[model samples]
Target: MTIETDRLRDLVAAELGRARDRTTLLTESVDEGDLIRQHSPLMSPLVWDLAHVGNQEELWLVRDVGGREPVRRDIDELYDAFKHPRRDRPQLPLLGPGEARRYVATVRDKALDVLSRSRLDGTPLVDQGFAFGMIVQHEQQHDETMLATHQLRTGAPVLEAPPPPAPAVPVTGEALIPAGPFTMGTSTEPWALDNERPAHQVIVPAFHIDRALVTNGQYAAFIDDGGYDDPRWWSEAGWAHRQSAGLVAPQHWSRDGDGWASTSFGRTQRIVADEPVVHVCFHEAAAYAAWAGKRLPTEAEWEKAARLDPATGRSRRFPWGDDPPAAEHANLGQRHLRPAPAGAYPMGVSPWGVHQLIGDVWEWTSTDFHGYPGFAPFPYREYSEVFFGPEYKVLRGGSFGTDRSACRGTFRNWDYPIRRQIFSGFRCARDA
Candidate 1:
């Protein structure tokens, strides 16, 4: 094997290990009761996620890539996510906490062995280690989901992380992205999901987008001005959901004297004025944009702001550049429990001076989930093809809980428009 091949293998192995560390942290933070319990109808039991990741790794790496025999063929059906829904997972026969831990550990041991000898440049699946990258991303994505379950679980705070750094510079207002064409997707990103493939040109007219995300204090103004109660500020569907759900503020927020407080991971704290507001659904974000005399950027517009480099007339791999994320770049990889104050991570800003565009929150966009112009599902259709429709809205960037292995400039995330349980927020944009 060449030196380059050795380095690539080492990098892939390190990423896999990083994802497992996070998964362990999320699953081991609580007792067996917490792991077995389904905290919300919207999420699966922690144990389900714990075992599902291992099942996927076994299917993709141990069996498919390495040509090894099945580790636990019987449990494949039990962990098939589409075969069972989140609300019904707790009722199904699932591995206990200890059993799940042992199962995943065994799978990881075998997977690492496969990595030690597998060719890194043969078929497309093995070339550049795409299959291994996919498995690492799958596990990290589930780690994020498990973290959300912890938030919904009823108990004392079981997670801990240091606060994000204070803002390094005062940030306010918006930045103008000059009207032009920029690449919107990636044909070259080895691990990019199918939906973000077939890099294509997107022409966006001149627009103004918030330099920073909508802060808690900014969102509070919308609530104060009857943003939720006024149907005029909401879409027909948003207003209907607002009424039916009886939403008065962003999820986890409550009235506190003349201010507001929010509970996170079982700990309640006074709302910080400059911190980005989170736990908001797409409807809430759109309505808030309307109330502010702006609108949520279309998916194209959001991508232009995040990836386009004005000087070079090209799109980079991240807001900052093609380099992988670092601690000083964005608040990702569950390194922090909450978003940093606006204006933090000056080094993370896009070429257009858009702050916090790549992390802290999954910024909602106006576009529905869809395939790129020349999209084709690589290995399976269930990953992206099944979800391409109006039923799911596109969310760009990532969030504090997102892992770097699963995120990039072209990465796309989608969910029901009414979902607020996930770590989500938005920045308003306007035509210039």
Candidate 2:
């Protein structure tokens, strides 16, 4: 291996280790009952996630990349995510915590061995350690999902993190993004998934976007104004969904006397008025935007705000620059269980002065989830190709629970319009 290859190998191993550590932190504090219990029909059992992480690693790294026999072929079907729905996972014969830990540890040992001797070039899977990066990212994604499970579990607080730093100054009003064509996606980002592929030019008209995400105080105004009750502000579908679900405010939030409070990861606390509103679905975000006489930015507009630099006319890797996220730059990587106060992370602001565009909450965009022109799926179609359509809305940026490896300026997240289990929020956009 060359110097570059050696460095890549180390980075891949380190990321895998970090992901595993996060998974352990999320699951180890709970008893076996918690691990096996499915918190919601939308989410798998914690133990299923644990073993699925190992099963995916074994399939991709040990079986496919190394061309080795399957270590535990009998369990392969049991852990196939596509074959089994999350609702049925608890009934399956999932590996217990002890067995799951041992199994994954064994898989990791072999995967590292494969990494040690395997060439990091040729083919898309092996080229530039793509397979290794994929596995690391996959585990990190599942770690985020497991964290969500922890939040949905009805029990005492198991996860803990200090609150994020308060904003230095309050950010008010909006940023006017200049109208023109800017690169929307990435062709150079190594670990970028298929949906964010084939960087292309996107021409957006002049627009005004919120300087920061909508704060709890701001969202409170909407709730106080009866934003949910006013059907004029909601799309027909959104209104129907809201009515059926009986949603009055953001999920996990409740009216506490004269104020609002929220529960997260089994811990209940008063809502921080200055922090960005979270646990909101796309419908809620859209309705808030509509009530405020604004609209959700399109996926292209969101990307341009986060990536384009007007002076140089170039797309940056992040809002700040090509440098990776740091504690001072953005609130991410499970560093804080909740979002920082809006207007925080001035260091992470985009060239247009859009604050907290990279992290805090996954910002909802108006566009539906779809592929760019000339899109092609690599390795498998299930990852991105199959999910494209109107059913899912695009969400830009990452949340507090998102790992840096799984997030980027061009990274895309999607979910149903009414889903609010994830840490989702939005910044409004309007015509300039």
Candidate 3:
């Protein structure tokens, strides 16, 4: 094989291993009981995620790419995400924690073997090692999900990470993005998912966005101002859902005497005013924006702030540059359980001076989820196509729990507007 092919194989192997390591850490940190138990109706049992990642690896890499026999054909239906919802996953005959670990390990061994021998330049799935990249990203996505499960589990904190560093430079106020058209999607991001395809141009009016994310202290003021009780600050649907859900503060937060505290990963601590507020649904973000006389940015505006460099008139792969994410760039890959202070990653700021745009929180956007113009689904429709519509809202920027493998400037994540269990937050935008 050529040197380039050898390098591709090694890179693919490393990423696959990286993703699996995180999966192992998330599952093995707790006992078998925690592995099988569903912490909430919103997420699957940890073991289900474990074995499901393996099943996907086997189907895509070992069987489809390598043309090998099925590893466990009968169990495919058991791990099918659409067939079995999170609420019902606990009752499924899932592989035990140990069994799931062994299954994934075995699959990884064979998948690597296939990668060592397979050509990386043929077929759409294998081209540029997209299938391998997809599998790596798939596992990392589940790792993030498993990390969320860890956060939801009731017990002493079984997982730990030192706090993210304090802000390097003082970041306050807003940054202005001039009005113009910039590339909105990607045709060049080799591993980009189908939704962020067919690079498109979006013309955005001039706007100013928060230099940093809204912090806990800022959100606290909203709550104190009766942001929830007032319907005028919320949309009709948002107000209805707010009343039904009995909305108070962000999830896991409670009034601590005259102050406020939050429970995270089974430990209760006082809320840090500087940390970007998380666990907030889209409705809460929108309400907070409305109260502040602003609005959640449309996805295009958010992208322009993150990717466009006015001097070069080129869109970058990340806020910092084309280089992959680094520890200093943003809080990612579960490195720290929570986000750093709002202006923490100065080195990671965009050319437009937007801080922490690539991580910290999945910033909510005002735009409803939809396919870009000239979009086409590749591999499968289930990944991005089926979910397209007004019912789901788009979220940009990966959060603290998001992995670099699955996140980019063009990456898109969507969920129900009312769902808050996932790591989410927002920065307000206003017309220039």
Candidate 4:
């Protein structure tokens, strides 16, 4: 193998090893049987998740690559996510702690050896990229599951840690962006999800997309104005959503008159008026937009406004010219696990003046979540396939808890209007 290939292989191997190490360390905090019992229904058992992740890697990277099937044929039948019977995973020989960890260690060693000598050049790297991607994702997911599992097992939230002192707010002014035919979606790059395919032209007439997400104080204004009680501020769907859930405000918002408080790291702290409102739902955002005489941007318009390149109409992994999100810029998971003041990342701005497009909070758009033309499922059968119609609307950008890689330009996410749990919220755009 070439030096570049060798180096890449080694790096990939190391990444997997790091996941192994993290999971190992996390296990020390709780008893294994108790962990499995607590989070069983919400998360797969540790042994099951571990074996399945590795078995999936081998199946996709080896057997599907026009290479020989695994020495154990049943491994695919046993561990493949597509193959595994959903919502019925507990009956299997889910691994115990020591055994499950050992299984992960063994399969990883085998995968490294196979990859080091495999001849998969010119073959689509989707299997290779997504396999490694999902494995890392799965392990990291396991870490979260274990934590939540511990809570489910223990009946209390585990991440009850407090945040450090707040950074003083910056005084800033409105940024004006003159809009035009801003082309939307990915115009460059080969690897992207099905929702981002058929990279086509979109015409966005001039409009004012907010320079930042709606802030705590701004949302408070809506609440103070009786936005919920007034019918003029809500669509039929939005009104029904509000009435069904008995939701009157953003999930973490609290006001005691003299001051405000917002939830952070699973605890409440003094509210910063300028902080963008995170942890809201599509329904809540729609109502707020209606009240403001603005509407959510179409997914096309949101993508166009958020796109960074002029020459290629390329998608960006982040806004502000694709330098991965930084602490000073956005309030992503790596940060306080909470909202950040909007406009925190000036250099991270898009081609237009849209801020917080990458992280901070996922912004809900008016567009319904649907697949592009000629879309097909890859490894996971029901990923983008299940929600490919108008039943759900599109959401752009990402939230504080979002996986950074999952927020790439052209990436699409959808949820029923009622799912306010994912830390999603929105900004509005006025028709020009």
lDDT of each: 0.93, 0.91, 0.93, 0.63
What digit string (tens of lDDT, one per residue) describes model 2 on residues 165-187? Answer: 98876788899998899998888
Give the TM-score of each candidate. Answer: 0.99, 0.99, 0.99, 0.79
**TM-score of predicted structure 3:** 0.99
TM-score of 2: 0.99
- For model 2, state the Cα shift of residue 82 in Å: 1.3
Per-residue lDDT tens digits for candidate 3, residues 1-432, read 789888888899999988988888898899999889999999999999999999999999999999999889889999999999899999988999888888888998899989988999869999989999999999999998888888889987899898899889998999999999999889988899899998988899999999999999999999998888999999999999999999999999999997799998988999999999999999999999999999999999999999998999899999999999999899998889998997789889999888999888899999999889998998899999999999999999999999999999999999999999989999999999
Cα lDDT of candidate 4 equals 0.63
- Output the lDDT of residue 429, model 1: 97
Report the C-alpha displacement of residue 397, candidate 2, in angstroms. 0.1
Q: lDDT per residue, candidate 1, 1-432, as tens digits?
A: 999989999999999989998998998889988989889999999999999999999999999999999999999999998999999999998999899999999999999999998998869898899999999999999999998888888878999999999999988888999888999999899888788999999888999999999999999988998788789999999999999999999999989999899999999989999999999999999999998899999999999988988888879999999999999999999999999899889999998888988779999999999999999997899999999899999999999999998889899999999998999999999999
Residue 378 alpha-carbon offset, candidate 1, angstroms: 1.6
Q: Could you tell me the TM-score of candidate 1?
A: 0.99
Clashes of each: 0, 0, 0, 1
lDDT of 4 by residue, 72-181 (tens): 55555666556555356667655566765665666666776666666534554433444555555556545544433343343323343333224343434333334555
